[model samples]
Target: MDTNNFEETIKPFFWVAHKSSFSVCLNAGSYKPEIFETREDEGFEGNGYDWGSLARVFLDERKPHLAEYVRFDPEAGMFCAYSSNPESLKEFIVDFKKACEDDAVINDLFSRAELD
Candidate 1:
């Protein structure tokens, strides 16, 4: 598939909050994605999950260069996935979507919310 063309044709946004926050954005590369800490007033309510520690673990497991493009702020309990490579971004979306579908907790969380 021509992921670059596909990516260019769509602007997608995804948000998930559990014990932490995770978001995905397609076509966000041009926006110069950056890491920003979330504030307590932002309504991130969760317990027992250390977002910062999780971010570090995730980053450590990936290639070092990925850290340059992806941003994770544990303090704010958020992770932003962005990359200049459309194919990589597309792959991330596909993999994450499948994971969410397979995970009962994630499926239930999304299904119950009126995200629309």
Candidate 2:
């Protein structure tokens, strides 16, 4: 992998801890998208940062390997693997970032940068 290029891609954005208002996992590869509660119920333990992996599914298809978000309160970028393969999450983060950029509500949420 081109570690430097990957690092470069991630570097421009500010890392912030994200609390996903809505989250789920899905078996979209199947006939229809189905939620995976097993992953959801795990809650905070679901992923180190507790990000919803399924959200990646909604991300830009151009980046098919959507992965993890770099949370700021947690305040550092840490790599975590996808469920089946280890590559999905990076693209997910990129897509998510784009979504936030394109949508105001999402961008607003991150703008406050303080949670109660």
Candidate 3:
């Protein structure tokens, strides 16, 4: 949330990383119909973003409470990161910001691969 940070500064790097990993999902052939054919199949949606999606991706399993990547410890509500290595999580946040800032970068990254 650094207002001074510009997307252009991080977009190129974000695109590279996103493409390398997400290209697989884009090309999964059956992914779209199987997972996205209907709104219901798409899990949760809001503002064109899946707010809790990252938690689901990280946990990859059902749990009673939402899996919080950044969590509050129950004993004292102390903040803790539940899932990834701290550096990786930081990089991901940066990448997300970059993607959001540059629509062209986001477009190209997704266009490079097909969801179906």
Candidate 4:
């Protein structure tokens, strides 16, 4: 995942994920992940570049959607998972959080999600 132009590489993956409606960063971190409805917004107070929002540098290519599988870690990279039953956000988020803690469980959830 090493590259000279980080934005060029990461932006496309996120764009595809956004369009496909995949969730991102399903973890137990303090900041929870989100599933966005649109991408009509951009910029940080017009681009101040807040700390720890590294994804923006590349995603700022057009202001990335908030819906992509999301718990981002500058050091560890992105980990993603999904669920078909998004009708209940609270319940699924809880499931995602618990599943994300284990790689196998999250992958299993993603596999099951893909079948639906």
Model 1 lDDT on a 0 to 1 scale: 0.37
TM-score winner between 2 and 4, please give it: 2
Question: lDDT per residue, candidate 1, 1-116, as tens digits?
Answer: 55455433333435333344334542222221211112223432321122333233434443444555555333233335545554444455454434334445333332232211
What TM-score number comes out for model 3? 0.29
The order by descending lDDT is: 1, 2, 3, 4
After aligning candidate 2 to the native by TM-score, how far in Å is the CA of 46 from where it should be? 19
Q: Pick the candidate with the highest TM-score.
A: 1
- Ten-residue segment with the worst summed lDDT in candidate 2? 70-79
Candidates 1 and 3 compared by TM-score, better number: 1
> In candidate 3, what are the lDDT values of residues 11-82, reduced to their tens digit?
322222242221101111221222222233434222112212422233233232333443321111111223
Q: Lowest-lDDT window of 10 residues in candidate 3?
A: 22-31
Off by over 4 Å in 3: 1-82, 113-116
TM-score-based ranking: 1, 3, 2, 4
* Ranking 1 against 2 by TM-score, winner: 1
Say which candidate scores most in lDDT: 1
| Candidate 1, poorest ten consecutive residues by summed lDDT | 30-39
Give a tens-digit lDDT track for model 2, residues 1-116.
Answer: 34356544543332232353222222122211112222334332222232233232343233443423321122112223233322344545455545534555343333322211
**C-alpha positional error of residue 9 in candidate 4 after TM-score superposition, expressed in Å:** 31
lDDT of 4 by residue, 22-75 (tens): 343422222222211011133212111111232323232222342342332322
